[model samples]
Target chain A: MVKVTCPICGGKLDIPEDSLPGELFEHEDCGAHLELVINEGRFELKLAEEIAEDWGQ
Target chain B: MRIGLAYDLIRWEEKALAYTIKDLGHTLELIHVPESVFYLTEPTIRGLDVTFERCVSFYRALASSLTLEAQGVFVVNTFDVIRNCGDKMLTTAVLAKKGVPVPRTMIAFDKVRALEAAKTIGYPVVVKPIYGSWGRMIAKADDESSLLDILDFRENMPSPHFQIHYIQEFIRKPGRDIRAYYLWGEVPVAIYRVSRNWKTNTALGARAEPANLDESTKELVIKAGEAMGSGVLGVDLMEDEDGRIVVSEVNAVVEFKNTVRVTGYDLPRKIVSSTVEALKA
Candidate 1:
């Protein structure tokens, strides 16, 4: 498991090692949606942008 | 009532929709379209009163909705409605055919013709792809020189769509544009996306505020929605320099995340209810 910290609320969370780079999951303590990205085998979390219904143009 | 949600990702709209579906005392079926496959014979997916086409991909959304409807499922935005509104050209044609006002537009196939069409429409015209969202690939050609440059860039582009030119008169308006949510021709919520940029898409950092829609604007929005036979749609309107409301675009699979935020209206509840109302008949 990868230990991740929420950037918004500073909450600690664990992400599975096998999770894909673009996998989106919610923070346990704050419920903020975060995307897991792997950079050179290191885990980085990014706050996922909310998509509007007709997002792409 | 049993409802099926066909989607690619669970955005805030979907989450709220699920909650509203449950709260409305209906069974929710999350049918992730990306993982699901269609069969020619006896697909076996049943018990759905109405399946909402919430997929992000326009092609996939239309195809899946049509496939599911073929297999005895009713999609919220029917194939006919989605098809009409999905294409920018078709939307404009329908609106114009229905006597609803739209910006003057011209379509051309090559650079020379595109330039000719631009000259006819005058300079600083808005150029956009036939099928797109978020104001991406939408630009303005200030003059013959810049228009040629813009067309030249698209000339070398790989996509065949770029080969076709969609040029329209740029409506100089107040620094804001209106995006209204319509369910079966009813305006549930409307918001003004305020931005200094000419392209005022909420996704492009436009500040969303509640819109004060006039009676005529609301009526025109309904007409625009009905023209495309859309049960759920996003009607984008902008006032010209003369304050005339010109229908800009109509989105079939409408998104209301920003609309909900600005108005605090029960976006999903209205969607679910409007869908139910549409199915009634």
Candidate 2:
């Protein structure tokens, strides 16, 4: 039940625990995707698209 | 009254500190940072005793001499805040976590992963050095190849680099960004930074203009500063397409050239007075 938000529209997002550390979580409200990573002992988010096909699958 | 000013040879901060000390009738101890330690390693306190051994070699010498327990000395901004603000990746992550609006950003450890991440972030994304300032090494990429070319050059360099996760919004005011200067949670002045280049930094030949401190902008700046737990700050902000404001970054020990010139406010006096009051309490 991790709380996330849209990088573009600032809407609330729900991130499933199974999502990989470097996966992208898209916001339903504004279609904004964020890059998720673990930094400084907590889950951090970044806005990134996938380079290869094996991203956020 | 002798006060020690510690910073690298950045003209803005240097001038601000000099003016403040001189006007306040205090002797200034100018600590000239040599080329070797211009980029000090970010500080982290591991279980007390304040170890700086992990910092660069040159800082080891300076760290040992610093009196962390000095009485009657007012640190312009504490070392802790400076360390946090120095890392862009860390700073944005903290602000975003606290529900502050920050542009979308990302960081990857290696080039392979970074390439994958960059593609996911999409085109027209900005790539910035994780530990850089004054708009140095900031690049915009429209595709994977361009990003790779930039990354290849950066990887070959001696310093480390990180990718900026894209923020899907136009610069509300092109070649312009807002900087709000705060003293102890109060904004004394707000300045708009304008430049023809994408990076609107005063250091990069940008022009400075006085900005009206609207209530919402002021609130956002204050919230961003408080999120980072910074006392004296220069907060960078921009508006999105939907007219929503998001914080770009926060600098702990802010440079005050354009701020002073635009607002016609004495930033040094405000900083010194606020610092001294904080120390007294």
Candidate 3:
């Protein structure tokens, strides 16, 4: 179990490695959508708000 | 090297590939694909060793066969990615689910739900066919009556009808959108598609001009392509009202005549190189 801290609200949550690629899981506490990016030997956590804001900008 | 170019012969873009292949000293076999191949069903799949009954299935079959048969098969924007990108509803859902930036979009199964969703999203929404390309069947509903008229027209259509989820919000610059061309996950060239009309597609007679790519735009294009799992993609983007670059659509196999004219890049050579690498892998 890997614990992920939400970038938006700074809340903590656990995510399994078997979670679907590109799946958007919301933070239970803040309702902030979180995304998982997987690459070679690297994992990145992204906030949904950032995606929305980046595209809007 | 021998390369198999698979596309419908009726499409003008296919000729572009042939020209490029000939220029690169490669033997190109132009395989004409039928529309029925894309919409194959059980009844259509009789007496074959393999049966492709769905659009996705057909795409996979085509890709797998080419990948196996050719020494360096360049499937110009692969069929799997094309199948996914061609469906607006599916593409929107997948992008949104994957945390990609798109407009406020919704899909409805029927006309009533579509109308309600349109109203909820507000006026000036763009209604598109679920499987449309080149900006066909796209209607801008500015009021309730226009929305209703579109729905009524759609409902009265012949077989295989579905209500598309329209998008409403932050109308961007008209007749201006960016097309970032990627080959093997790297963007070699980009173009700004400009038009006097609402649609910014070469097929719609839009003019193409060279565009400079900033780091942010490049990053966004790469991210959008990665999200869609397409190695080669044309990431269509537009700046919204807030100047944020929102992804409009992602094309797996993009026509590059206009892009090449603008950027002066040898697109087919790049694609062939990528195809060789992919096949080796």
Q: Rank the candidates by TM-score, best first.
A: 1, 3, 2
Report the C-alpha displacement of residue B160, candidate 1, in angstroms. Answer: 1.1
Ranking by lDDT: 1, 3, 2
- Model 2, B1-281: lDDT tens digits are 55655533224445565666668876755443222233234442122211111111213223422333132223445555655666677788889899989876767666687777766666767777666567766777777788788877777776433333322323445568888886677887888888878788887798999999788788888888888875788898876556778888787656776678777888878877776565556
CAPRI grade, predicted model 3: incorrect
lDDT string, candidate 1, B50-107, tens digits: 9888877777788888898888998878888887777888888889999999999999
lDDT against the true structure, each candidate:
0.83, 0.62, 0.62
lDDT of 2 at A4: 67
Q: Weakest 10 consecutive residues, lDDT, candidate 3 chain B? A: B47-56
Interface RMSD of 2: 19.5
Q: Pick the candidate with the highest lDDT.
A: 1
| Residue-wise C-alpha lDDT for candidate 3, range A1-57, written one tens digit per residue | 677777788877787765433445778898877765545535556764232110110
